[model samples]
Structure formats: C-alpha cells, structure tokens
Target: MKKKIINGFLQILGIMIVGAIIGYSVGKIAGDSLSKVDTPNIILLLIAGVVVFILQVIIHEAGHLVFGLLSGYKFISFRVFDFKIIKDENGKLKIRYERLAGTGGQCLMRAPEYVEGKFKYRLYLLGGVIFNIIFSIVSWLILPSYYTLLFALIGFVLAFLNLIPMGFNDGMTFYHASKDETTRFILHLQLEYIYYQSIGKNLLIEKPEIVEKINSLEITNTNYLTDALEFIKLDGLEYFFEFDALYNESRKLYIERDDLLPVYKVELMALLVKLISLVNPEDELLEELMNDKSLKVRLKQNNPQTKNILATYENGVKLDDEKALNLINEARKIKNKAPNLYIQNLEMKYCDYLENNIIK
Candidate 1:
C-alpha cells in the first residue's frame, strides 16, 4: 500500500514538472507575441496556462471518476493536478492527465474486473470518452468564451482521439469491451505476427507443414482459418471457441474434418473438465485427465487443446479438492518440462492443496 502511494505521488510529481515546463514555454511565446500590442503580462499568461492545465486534468479525470462510479465500478482514489492515479481494491489502476500542448487531454482507466461480458465492459470503456464529450459540449454552451472554448476544443480532440479503437489507446479498450469477433481475430493475427517476429521465426517457413495441411483442407478464406488455427495452437482452444462463437460458420468446417478429430476431442475433453470442475472439485473426469501421463505430456505441447485442458484443470482446482488433487497429479507428470515461473507456482499450490486438503 505504501509503495503504491509513493509510486502514485512520484508519477504525479513528474507530470507536474513536465506540465509546468511546457506551460512556461507557452506562456513565454504568448507573452512575446503580445509584447508590442499592449504587452500582456507574462505572469498573467503563465497563470492562465497553469489554470488551463489544472482544469483540463480535473475535467478529464472527473469524467472517468463520475462515469466509472456510476457504471457500478467502485471508486478508488481521485486526484487532480499532474498525473492522477486511481485504483480499486482489486488492483485496477487508472491514470489521468493533460498534455503539455494544452490542446486537449485524457483519462485512462484500467479495470481488471471489467474483463468478460460485452455490454458491461463496453460501458466501462466508453465511460471516460462519454464524459469528455458531454463535458466539452456543456462547457462550450455555458462557460465564458475564452476558457470555455479552449476546454471544449480540448475535450473534443481528446474524445475523438480516444474513440479511434486501436493499439493501447482508449479505442482498443472500447473494441475489446464490444467483443467484436472480427476485430479480435484480426488483432490476434497481428499479435501472432509480432510474436513470431520477436522469436526470430518466419511464420510462413516455420509452419509450412501446418500451412500445407490447412490449404489441403480446402478452407475458404484460408488466412482467417489459418490464423484461427495458429491462435488456437498458441493461446489455447478456449480462445478459438471464443472466436468461433462469433464466426459460427467456422464450426461447420471443423466438424467436417476427420483428421481434426484429435484436436476436437482434446477440446471437448477440456470443455468437459471445465464443466465438471464447476459442478464439483472432486470431479472424476478431471482426476482421470490429470492422472493420465499422455494427457499431461500433450498439454506441454502448447497445442490449443492442451492449453484449454490446463486452463480448465486450473480453474477446476480453484473450486474443489478432488479437482486440486487431479491437477496436482497432472502437474507432477510434466513438472520438469513446464514452462515459466507461473507453472512452478502452480506446482507449489498443488502440493499445498494435497498436504492441507487431500490428506485431511
């Protein structure tokens, strides 16, 4: 808690220093321009810039605070001037600020709890954008000309930019919230390309056999299917199902393929594991899958079916002791080959579950 508070304070302080420097520069420029025609007070212009900076930050962040709270999000912290950091108990963080250019501003709200479900997520995403647009229009109509016009313009620009729906910006948040299948599929493809490039592999050459197999299947618009297959391979089949539900027609193609049975069966088993885990932790099906060495080894392959199996088993253990034992057995089978510190942590958790719950 102390660390977070300190970090927030430093972030705000940094923004203040940057804002002040920019404000001073703008003040000097405006002051110089007006020197001949009545020489407007440099001090006054600087003060106005500071005021604008403060107001922009307040209104921008206020949009996030008001709308976020109104939309069922619990209020975290609200601050103005420099960078504003807000966080709920769930560790979700939102940061707000005005650009030094003084044209407009932004409030970025992150809600981890906001994941899943389309409509509620969309509201959480659009909350800040909506606030800025409404506030900008209201300011234009009611506030005095000088400051009001500036604020309105700032609001308009920021709101417009945020609605773009790309990258790490607010638009991406809106897109994800919408759960638009096409957009997600495309984004997944792009991310995959980046991932392969990062790993120094040419995706085309690296998976010629898989690509050839996909082509031989005579899939229409093979790019989409290929990408979908690849994503399933990398992330897991659950995400494939997520994408498939959006593009329901794709399911027909998968159903017709005899060679795809292994993948499909694995996915089915994974889904069943998930369902059983939800009903009871001591589900026999989950235990069977966990105890099977072949299933555990297959999971290490990082295939879509394997990923879903692991994920299902993990979620299942959270709900029941029988499931946890099953998951522990599964973990023990391939403990040496499991990837990353996360898997190591899972191993520890399974051992703890066995010791404290299974024996008892």
Candidate 2:
C-alpha cells in the first residue's frame, strides 16, 4: 500500500512538473509569435492544431517502426487511432480497423532472438521521444510562424509526456528494460509469444521451452508488461489443459489485482466464467460476471473466443445445450476471421472443448 501511494505521488508530481514546463514554453512561444504577426484566425488555428496532432501521432509510431527495424525487429503492425496496417498470416500487409482505449497509436514488431542475455531495445523504445524532440526543435527554430509554434508546442509536450515514467507509457517500459534484466527477458518472451502466434506456432506443443520459461517466472515486477507476461502464462496453462491450476491462478489474479488493464480484466473474467461453469454451474461469481457490463461488451465483440466463452456459459451453467451448440458452430466459423494463426488455433481448440467436453 505504501509503495503504491509513493508511486502514485511520484507520477502525479512528475506530470505536474512537466505540465509547468510545457505551460511556460507555450506561453513564451505564443507571445513571441503573436508579437511578430497580426492576430491569427482562431478557426484556422484550431483546424491546424487538430491536423498537426494527428500527424505527430503518426510520426511518433513511425519512429518506433524505423528504430525497431534498424534494431533487427520485424514489423507486425502499425496503427494510428482506429486505422491499422498489419502483416497478416499470409505475410502481406493489409489494412484493418481496431482500437484500444487510451493509446493514440502503436507500433508492434517481432523481437529479435535474445542472444547472450541481451537484445537491442533501447533505441526502439526511445525512438518516439527522439523523433518528437527533433521535430519540435525544427518547428520552433526553422519555421518561425504561429502554426509552426503550435506544432512545436504540441510536439514538445508529447515528448515530455512520454519521456516521464508514469502509467503505461513507453518511459515506464524503458525504465524497466534499462534497470531490470528479468523485465527485459519477460519482454523478449512476450514478443516471441506474439511472433509465434502470427506464424501459427503452438507454444504448448511446438515451443514447450517457451511455455516452461513462462511457467517458471514469478511475477516480481509491478509493470503492466509484466502483467502481460503473466497473462500469456495463464493462456499457456489453458492450452496445456491444466484446468485446476488455471482456475486457481485466474481466480487469485482476478480477486487480488484491481489495477489491471481493462482488456486484461475482461479476458481474465472470461476465463473465470468458463472455469466456474465447468466446475460449479451455479457459482455466485458466474452471476456477477454475467451481469457485468464490461463482460457483456467483451462478449459482444466479433471475436471467436468471446463466442466460445458464451457457449461454455450456456452449456455448462444454463443447461441450454442447443444454444451452446449453435454458439460453438458460430465460434468455429468466426475463427477463420481471427487476426492471426495463433488465435485461430486457440479458437478452434476452445470450440472443440466446448462441444466435446463441456456441453451435455
């Protein structure tokens, strides 16, 4: 509790400090620009601000893509807002629409092999910050116009926001990478986990060593990325058909960790619902989860896993075998549209599990 309080305090304090710096810089730049030119059009300036902000977000993610490729990382996806360009299972780049809460953009890459206890990560992690700083400097010094000043101001603020180690920002992830070897190793494993999924590599059967490493690791770090590591471990357990252990671990994580990313919370809850349905159909937690709006939203998504979980709930808990069977069929068909081979495999397996084992 004390550690959380101190960390929270530090995060708030850091944000305030950066806010002050940005405020002062913006004032100075705006004053200087206004003194040199006539009154600027407010409507035009607002439009320009919006355009510049979107462009900066693209540049930021592009920085990660550039630096990651240079560091031997392979591209997986690049997304800005809701638009994404992803390397599909066919090894072709295709446009898709997806968005996560809180982030404006993302650049995902397949990690290089972890050789000799090290892999290139520093430049890739700091690439966005570097690009933002460079662009801001250029806007402020070379292009001395009001619009350019606005661009500089926004870029400068974005750079500092990401540079500070708070929340789920790149700064915090980089901080862990720089200071903790375990975190770095976890990151490598996590990235490799995704890479394997993209290629339809089953970690349980084909990459048992990876699953063993995941099972061996203790969740010693408080980082969300570490939480992600733990998440895949639970996933591996499910794939290995370790139901009892998966139940206990999933329950413990669900009950104890309230600070999980929303997506993780929903995923874990879905897992729990399946477990509870198989074990004790009338479990109170099942009712609670069923009533949860977030869970409902997740179930409504067009993903196969969601349909499978709902199938399990219907079959095991509600004794609606017909509905459950229909859901299983739907899940199987939906698996064809899964984002990657890994997910497609899991979805198919889960649908089979529901049909053969869970449903009466």
Candidate 3:
C-alpha cells in the first residue's frame, strides 16, 4: 500500500510538471496570436482545441497502423473513440462502433511470425510516438496560425505522454519490451493469439502450445503484459468449462492486483458475479457485486461478454429467467458485430452454453 501511494504521488507530480511545461508553451505560442485579435472567441477556441486533440489521436493511431504494417504485422482494427475500422472474417475492412474503457483510440494488429525467439516490435510499439512528434514538428513549420499552434502543441504533448512510461501507454509497453526478454516473448504470443482469433482459430484447441506458454507466465502484476496473459488464461479455462478455476483466478486478480487495468478489473468483477451465481447462487459476493453502482455503470456498455454474464446472473441468482433470456438473445444478435471475430466466436459459444446447458 505504501508503494502504491508513492507511485501514485510520483505519477501526479510528473503529470503536473509536464502540464506546466506544456501550458507555458501553449501560452507563449497562443499569446502572440491572441494579441493580434481584439477579442478571443473562447467557445470557438474550446471547440478547436477538442478537434485538434481528436485529430492528433487519429494521427497517433495511424502511426501505429503504418509502422505495424511496415514491421510485418497484419492489421486487425483501428479505432478512434467509438468509431472503428476493422477487418471482418471475410478479410475485408468494415466500419463498426465500439468503445474500450480507458483508451482514446487503439490500433490492433496480428503480429508477424515469431522466429528464433524474436520478432519486429520496436517500430510497431513506437510508431505512434514517432508519428506524433513528426507531425508536431511539421505542423509548426508549415504555419504560424492559432490552429497550427494548437495542433503542434497537442501533438507534442501526446507524443511526450506516450513516450514516457507512466501508465499502460505505448511508452510503457515499449520500455518493458526492450528491457525484458519475457515481455517481448509475451507480446509475440499475444499478437499471434490475436491473429488466430481473427481467423476463427481457437488457441486452446489448435494451439495448445500457445495456451500452455501463456498459462506458464508469472502473474506478478508488475506490468500490463502479465495481467493480459492471465486474462487470456482465464479465457482458455472458461472455454473448457472450468468454472471453478475461472472463478478462483478471476477473484484472485480482482482482489489482489492493485495495478489491474480498469477494463480487466470490471470484466473480472462481472465474471465473478456470473461464476458465483452458477456455482453457488447464495454466495454473498453476488449481492455485493450486483449492487455495486460503479460496476453497474460500467456494465451498462453494449459489450457482449458483459451482457452474457449479466444474463447468467439474472437467471441463476435473481430467477428472472425472462430478463436473462432477453439478455442472452441480445448478446447473440450482436456477437457477430463485435470488432474482433475471436470475441464474437467466444460470445456465441458462451450464449449457446448458457442456453443449452445452464439457462434451461
């Protein structure tokens, strides 16, 4: 607890220092431009700022896509906010709407084949930072207008934040990957696993070696990579109907991992509710999880897995079979519409399991 508090304090201090630097830069650049105007339109400036931030985010993710392709990684999906361009099962790009908590945008790719314990990783990982920095410089050099200044400033700040290992950002991943052999290997495995999922291949069955490797990793919660691998392991366990193991692991991560990502944490909590309901509907954890206002808000998303878990909870614990059936039906309807085909397949199977084996 002391360590976590110290880390949190350090992170806040770093952010404040960086913010001060960026603020001074912004003021210096914008002051000259503002001096020329009789009155500044605050609302217009605010709108422009928002637009510039979004554009920079797009540019950053695009950097990842371009560099990932160059590094021999295959594109899976690119998202800006809720809008996404994803490759469908037919190997064609399609537009979809999806949102991931704690991310402004994402660029996912199928990693190139791992050979001799190594693969191209640096370019793909640092692509966004490189792009943001390059664009910042280019934007500043091209024009001296207000929009240009904002663009340059925002881009630079984005690059800086991502280039430093603060959180689960690109810089953090790259930093760990460059230093740790295990991190690199884990990235390779994750990318390959994503590729298999994109093509409707189950790593657990067809690539049991991959599953074994993933499950063998140490879950120190020191980095997001370990947590991610553990999440994948949970999926494999769930795939084989090992609810006992799933519940225990999910509970362990949810309770023990103070550094757990919000995305993983919420999913685990929801999964726990479902598991407890299935195994022992009378478990006290169910009441607490179900009544959690924060968890309730997060679970209100349109995600298939969340809906499936909610469906199970309603059926087994609440005895609201009608609502449970509706939730499962809704999950099935949107399963194929998921950005990742692997998740789509998983949700479909889960729905089937609930209907055929559990929900009846």
Candidate 4:
C-alpha cells in the first residue's frame, strides 16, 4: 500500500513538473492571451476549455489513425473517453459510451502480421504521440490566435502527459512492447482476434499450435496484462493449470490496471478455474475479489447477461431450467463483446445440470 501510494505521488509529481515545462513553453510560443482570455462569463471559459481539451484528444486519436494507415494498419475502433466509434453488425459506424478510468481516448488499429523478427507495430503504437508532437510544432509555427493556442498548448501538453510510461499510459505500453517478440506476437494475435470480432465472426484459435509456440518461446517472465489477454483470446480455459499460473503471475497487475473491466475479468476467470478444479480456492482470494469496489460497481452497470454471470458467481445461486432458458433467451437479445464464453458455458451448464432436478 505504501509503495503504491509512493508511486502514485511520484507519478503525479512528474506530471506536474512536465506540465509546468509545457505550460511555460506554450506561454513563450503562444503568450498570455490564452490564460487571460477575454470572455463574458467564467462558465463560457470553462466550457471553451473543455471543448479544446476534447479536440486535442480527438487529434491525438487521429494521429494514431494517420500513422496506422501509413504503416498498413487498419482501424478497428476509436474512443474519446467512454464514447466509442466502432462498427455495428452491418459494418456501419456506431457510437456508444463505455466509461473507463485512465482513458481519455484511444485509437485501436488492427495490425498486419509481423514478419520474422520484424516489428512494424511500434509505429502504430507510437503514431498518436508522433502526431501530437507534430501538431504542437505546427501550432507553434503558425503562431495562431490565443484560442487556437489553447488547442495547440493542450495538444502539446497532453501528448507529453501520455509519455509518462506508467499505468497503461502510452509511454509504458511502448516501452514494454518495444522490440519484444513475444509481446509483438501477442499484439498480432490481438489484432487478428479483434478483426474477426469486428466482422461478427468467431475467431478459431488453434489451441495446440499456439500452446506449443508459447511453451517453446524463451520467455524470462510473462506480462500479466498481455499474456493473460493472449491466453484468454487463445482459449486458456482448456488449459486450466497454465491459465491458473498466469493468473497468479498477473493478479497484482490486473488489480492495479487503469481500467476496472480487467479486474472483473480476471476474477471471473479465477471462478471458472475453481469450478473446474478438484482443489478448492483459498477463501481469502474469493473474499478479496468480492470486496473489490470496482467490480461491485461494474456488476451493477453491466448488461443483463454480464450481470447474471457475476451474480451467479457471487451468490452461487443455481437457476431452474425455466429460469435458465429465460436467461439464455435474454442474453441472445443483448449485444456485447464477442467470445464471452463464461456466460455461454455457464448458461449451458445451468440447462444441463439444473434443468431436470426435481422441484418438490
């Protein structure tokens, strides 16, 4: 707890320092007109500030798109904070709100396969940063108006802010992922999976091939976020013991992940492992998961199927066949991210295990 708090303090300190530098630079380049804007009301200034901040975020995402396209990467989704622009069932663009912590916005690019020991993904990953810096330079060069300077300065500062390299920030993702073959492979696989899902298709992960390759790799250690995500994408449930080991390795990282969704996901995986295993879980693990504030909040906010699955785990409440079928029906009606197999399998289990039980 002390270490995490210290790290948090250090991160904040670094941001403030970097921010100060950027602010000074912006003032020198763009001047005090931005800070001392002439506005009718304070509320107008606040609203204008919000608008510019959001625009910078959009430009940052656009940077990713531009460079990703340049590098032969295809777009999957673009998110500004919780508002996502992604393809619907008909491959038409659809927008939805999905609030997440530590994410002001994002651009997801589907990468082409990496050639033997050749990684082209660093460009796509770094694309947004590269573009943000470029935009800042352009803004500085153009010597635009004070309001324009506000947009430019925000863009400049936000770009630098993303480079702090901790807690799912751009710099950290780049640092950890750079020149790492295993990590590159994980990225490749993720893109492939996302592509299949985008088209509303089930990606067939060849289990034996992937498992053998993962085993053969000379990995010193596995990253919790990357490896766990890869494992689940590759059907890790079939290899319960291996997934359990990865889960243990990634437990801390998952808990501390910037977003709350991963926390819920890992716990759900743990529960499935317990269901399949002959041995029981330590009571503490279960208690810890249940006590999670994010998971609790997430449970309340999710759609019905997600809510049901978590509810089942939380209460161990078995559903009757009639109720089980109803749940299955309801689940089919609500759309969600693909390959949520826990609910699917559990729904089937409810039918198989509970359907014929005598109710007196």
Top TM-score hit: 3
Candidate 4 residue-wise lDDT, 1-360, digit = tens: 687789889998988988888788767855554455453466765687899898888888898898889989877788898677876546678665454556788787778766768767777777777787787678756755655666677777788777767776677777767747777776676676656555644344433475566566666544543655544533454323344454454454444554433543645544443332212344245566556675566545444435344433432334343554454445444434322233334334443332233232
Per residue, candidate 3 scores C-alpha lDDT tens digits across 261-351 of: 7677777787898898777788777778878876897678787877888898888888888888899999987775565777777788888
Q: For candidate 3, what is the TM-score?
A: 0.90
TM-score, cand. 4: 0.74
lDDT of 2 by residue, 271-311 (tens): 89988887677667788888999888767776677777788
Q: List the candidate numbers ranked by lDDT, top first.
A: 3, 2, 4, 1
Q: What's the lDDT for residue 278 in model 3?
A: 77
- Candidate 3 stretches greater than 4 Å from native: 25-40, 215-221, 255-258, 357-360
> What RMSD does model 1 have?
18.4
Which regions of candidate 2 are displaced past 4 Å? 1-10, 37-40, 214-222, 240-245, 256-263, 291-300, 319-339, 352-360
Cα TM-score of candidate 2 = 0.83
Total colliding residue pairs, candidate 4: 1
Q: Which of 2 and 4 is the better model by lDDT?
A: 2
Q: By the TM-score metric, which is better: model 3 or model 4?
A: 3
- C-alpha displacement of 33 in model 2, angstroms? 3.1
- Positional deviation of residue 236's Cα in model 4 after best superposition, in angstroms: 4.2
